[model samples]
Structure formats: structure tokens, C-alpha cells
Target: MHDRPAPRPQAPPARPPAVRRHNLGLLLGALRAAPSSRATLAAATGLTRGTVAGLLDPLVAAGVLAEGEPDRSRVGRPGTPLVFAGSGPVVLAVSVEVDGVDALVTGLDGQVVHRSRRRRDHRGLDPDAVFGRAARTAANLAARTGRTVAGAGIAVPGPVRGSDGAAVLLRAPNLPRLDGCRPAEHAGALGEVPLLVGNEASLGALAHLGQADDFVYVSADVGIGGGIVVDGRVLPGARGVAGEIGHVVIERAGRLCGCGGTGCVEVYAGLPALLGDAGAADVAALRTAARAGDPAATGALARAGAALGTALTSVLHVVDVGTVVLGGSYAELGTWLVPAVHAELVRRGVATGPDVAVLVSPHGRAATVTGTARAVADRVLGEPDLLLAG
Candidate 1:
């Protein structure tokens, strides 16, 4: 205290964090709806034009937002339309599966600029080794992109406990044993950056949101997983263990599930399980066989559909989700599966009203990765905390 000079007359009080956050929200909202003028942005965000301008300055400097060409033809006053830089810091999204891991390096706009997949012996592999490989793959991709990776998001093929961010491999089918593994343990090798671990289904749900909430997304990938959103927020059930539809027991003392249960829905509906019984290489072949009136394939689809319907009935009973979206490789079978699911729901009379809908997911293989990238982007842009206040 004695050596230091007077605090330089104390700079004026800075703006409140709320004010900054509000302005930032406006900026991000505007950028998302790009090629918009200040007037349009103000109107869209209900912020004053001056405030929008002030916010845009810092964002522009940071390469998050950029000024578009001036609009000179309008009669009243010329305004510069705003556009996103689209080349800001990147977010690497990785999916850890039983047989291999898939990673996508995406830009700020949730576009996959680069992607790579690596195969490994998923069985008997240590959790640390798997995570290290994923982190290294992400780093190598980021280096190749020559862009600053702001963060990394990992989607595991199991129930990721929301409470502790640990990979809960207990109830998943075909996933490697990772009982007490946490994705955060691998963040250190990923540059100690902000890392996000989420269930692939939830991420897929977020991606299909496409900016809307209040939808239920069912992912029919290697296994069946689901994501439920209420009023625009994906609900993380207590312990981040929500949406374990795969383990919903459909039959008693029927086909045994890998999870030590008899006739779990995932046992029949999961592609791998069905493929094992059908002797088909993939779901597409199975679907083809089913469509061609192959008795076994048809019976399998019917069984899978009934189980899916029963499971969906449970979801509909608990959460009054308005829209049910089907996605992933098996979504191609939506033509058959959706009707069966709907029939079961109707037969069971789960919905009191006629508002519920079952639609195909708007995205395909890229859904989970894109959704994770969007999460990272929203976090960086200082979005309102959905968990705390949304």
C-alpha cells in the first residue's frame, strides 16, 4: 500500500455484467438471424439500436460478428447489415462408441468442417486409454484445421450421469465396461479446455430442436436412446440418468438383455441385436428384408415396434411431450416403426388430447455432433443460463 501510487484516480464504474450479458444476448440473437440490419436486430431482440451498435463493436473485434455491406438503397437512413464471421473459434465434437470413436471439427455455425473416425478394440480397453485416444484425435483434427478450438464436447454411447458427468455404462447395450469413468478425467489431455460430456441422444435432441423446444427425440442408432425437452430445455432427470429407454423391459422372461434383464426394449429394437438375429450386416439390409416381406425381418420389426411403442407410452405418460422426433440410421424405417408406435400409443390412450406428433429427426448422423457444437457456442456467446433460470 505504501509503494503503490493512487489508483490512477479510479476509472469510471464499468457496466454491470447483466447489462453486458443482455447486450451480448442481443448480439448473438442477431448474429444467428444474420444479414440483418440494426433496425431489424433491435426489433428482433427488443434492444435499442445504440445498444446493439455498442455490443457489435466488441463482438466484431473478437471475430464473432462482422459487418456486412452497407445498404444504401433504403430511403430513410443507410444501415449496415450484420453477419456472423462464421470462422470464429471452433468446437470439436467426438462420439465414443464401442467399436470406434467418431469426431467432427465444426465451426461456430455448427457446420462440420472436418471429420475423422478411428477403429479400436472396444472390448477390454481401459477407460483412460479410450479417452486419451479421443482427446488426441480431437487435438490432431484441431491442429489440421488451423483454428483455435474453444472447447470440446464428447458424446458417449451410454447414460452419462448428469450429477457427476461420469459415463454410466451400466444399462447400455454393446458399450464397453466403464462403470465409474468420468469424461472430465480426459479433459486434461484435451488442453484443459472446457469439456462437455452428454448422452448422444440428448445432444441429438438438442440438434433437432433447431431452435425450438418441447419435443421428444428418439435416437435409433446402435442402440435406442431418447431425449426429452420441455418448453425448449432438455430435461436432465435426477442424476443425469433420464432417458434410459433402452432398458425399459418390454417382456418378462423373453430374450435376455445384455444388461441382465429379460426382453428389454433395446434387446429387440437396437440395430446390433436385431442384426445378430437376422444375420444381416446392417439395419438397412434388415429394413430391406422386412420391406420385401421376409417373415423373420417383418416379425423382428413388428416385435421391435411393439416394444418401442410400449416404451414410448411410458415416456408420454410421464412427460407430455408434444412432438416425438425419430432420427439416426434406423430413422429410414420410420415409415413402418412410427405407425406402430403411434398405434400402440393410440391403443393405450396415453394422450388426452390430439396434439402429440411423431416426426422424423431433421438431422441424420451429424445431429449429436452439431448439437454439442451448438451448446459450446451458446456457452461462449454468454447465453442465458437455461439450467439456472430458463
Candidate 2:
């Protein structure tokens, strides 16, 4: 019988595309957290050595990962470290605030390769013009880096529809030009790259994911907004507005907000409201005044901190997070702001349970910009096929 046909071998089991994708993400995420050898990665990811090797081939080929020097410190055979490639894919991040726009080219490891800032009065600037400026800045950054641009992320001062990057600014009193404007319409210099538009505070919160598993990020710029992280994930809510803590009503008879609502936290805690003829041109000046015992500045910050505490109390009641991160301009005021906020929370009794801790963001005002780039880079890392396709 032809020597029994030599017992034909059976083909190995096939893994579905989704399973492969999931495994890829797991490996990439492990490397992102820290560089590791193949054996260590396999153990951490619960994938076999051979399976991890198989998954790493494509990533290495795509320049998403690089094999580092072998570890001679280990016994017997040495293991090479797998790390994010220095020349890996990058993302363009654009942050549009009330005053101006910032563009940055960031690597997968969240390092800013190139950065540019344009300070222009955006009060009545045309929305298209705003995007154009951002696009030009991004183009310049890309030209300087000469790396693959995986995608683009935009952090806007106003609300953005989560569905299709539509600007849902009912009325951005601070940034009226963005009102009724669709930023996605004009891709500007970014061209056909994938675009993601989100609230500045929402994206800013992502920068702190590595800092804590759960925390509330409050961004105090020209306006006040927040981002809530619950159990290591951002809570964008049903309409993607979960972290709009700025609009949470803190005072029943407070001043009118740009959203046409009364007593909104922003109406009291916003930069303009807090300044209120304090004779301080900017947050730095205001901080100096507060440090020098200017009652007006100190009083303004105290009231703002109280309003933040009120909104955050409601946030903690719902999300039960233990940490609140002061970001943006608030970070500059943390010396006094954190104390005032903590006092208010203590007064309201929300600071007792979980032992609430208020901290200043290491990224400071750059949190939103850094987080925006990180958000886009994360997507690219999750689905490296995008880079391969490009």
C-alpha cells in the first residue's frame, strides 16, 4: 500500500482573524507598558512562546516593534527584548482651545517628536481657518519627522458628536466660531488621514490612565470641563458627553451658562468667571496674585474649587472613583486649588470614603494635547493593519 502512504500529517488548527487581532493587541499592550523578552511576554500574555513569536513577526515587519539587545544576565540561553520601535508609526494631535491651537507629532510611546503652537484670537475666527492653521502645523511636524502618520486626533474646546466628529457646540461662548461648525467637513492639511474629534477634557483624561486605574480629570482652561475614568476606562457616557462636568448644575441660581443653562459649574468655575476683574491677564498672573495674598484672586479660586468639589461630589457618588486630577490651567493653581477642593469635599463628606486624593497632573496644561496624540497612537497600535495598509 505504498508503505501506508507515510501517514499524512494533519494541518494545524486555524485561529480566526478576530482571535489573532486580539492576541496582537495583547502583545502590543504588554510591550507598551514595558519592554520584555519573548519568553516574558508569552508568560504575561498567556500565549505560548511559539505563538508569541508568530504574532511578533508581522509587528516587527511593520516596524511597530523592535528586538533589543539580548539579556546576558539570565542563565543559559539569552532572551532578546521586544520594544516599541523608535521609528514606529506616529499620530498627529491638534488641540484647539479658546485662545489658539497646538499641533504635535507623537510616537507610539507617547513621546512628542515635533510640536508647534499657534496663538491666535479664536473668538470669531472662521472654523475653516482654525482647521487650516492646525493642518499646516501638522504638515510641518510630519515634514520634520518624516515618519508614517497613522492618524490625526483633534481636541476641541466645545462639544463634539461622537458619531461622526460633528461639532455639537450649542454655543461655545468662549469659542463662538466653533458654534454650528463641523470641523470634520474640512480635513484641512491632514488630508484623508483618519480623524477623531473629541472634547478637550475627555481626551485630556486619557493621559492619566497610566497614573491611576480610576480618577476624575478636571481641565480648567478658558472654560471648565472634565473626564471621568472608571476602572481603567474612560466613561464617555451614552452620548459621549459623560465627562461634561462643567455643565453640571452646581448652583440653582447661578449665572447663565453658554449652554443657556443656569447655575452650571462652568458659569462659576470657568477662567473668565474666576478672573472677574481680578486684574490678572493670565493664569500665571492670577496664581502669583493668589500666592501674594490677593484676596480677590484667592477668593475666586476658592469659589471655583468649591464649584469643582460640588460637581465632583456628584461624580464620585455615581462613579465612586477615589482620585481627582487637576489638569489644564487648574494644574497651575493646584497649590491652593487642591486644598480648597479637598476642604469642600470634606465639608460635603465625599472625601471620607475611599480616602479621596486630589493631585495635580504631571502633564499640566499639555495633558489634552498629549492625550489626543496618545489616543490616536493607541488605535494604531491596536490595529497595526492600518499601518500595513498605508
Give the top-scoring candidate (TM-score): 2
- Across 1-390, the per-residue lDDT of candidate 2 in tens digits comes to 011112223564788988988998888777878888877877788877777777787778878778888778877667778887889878889887777778888878787798877787777778787777777777778878878788888888866667245545444657676676667675578887888877888888989988887999988877778888876556756564678888888888878887778998887787888777466788889988999999888888888898888888888888878899998888888998898899888889888744999989998767888888878877777786676677
lDDT of 1 by residue, 139-170 (tens): 78878887767777888777777522344434
- Report the C-alpha displacement of residue 143, candidate 1, in angstroms: 2.0
Checking candidate 2 for backbone clashes, the offending pairs are: none
TM-scores for every candidate against the unseen true structure: 0.83, 0.90
**What is the lDDT for 198 in model 2?**
79
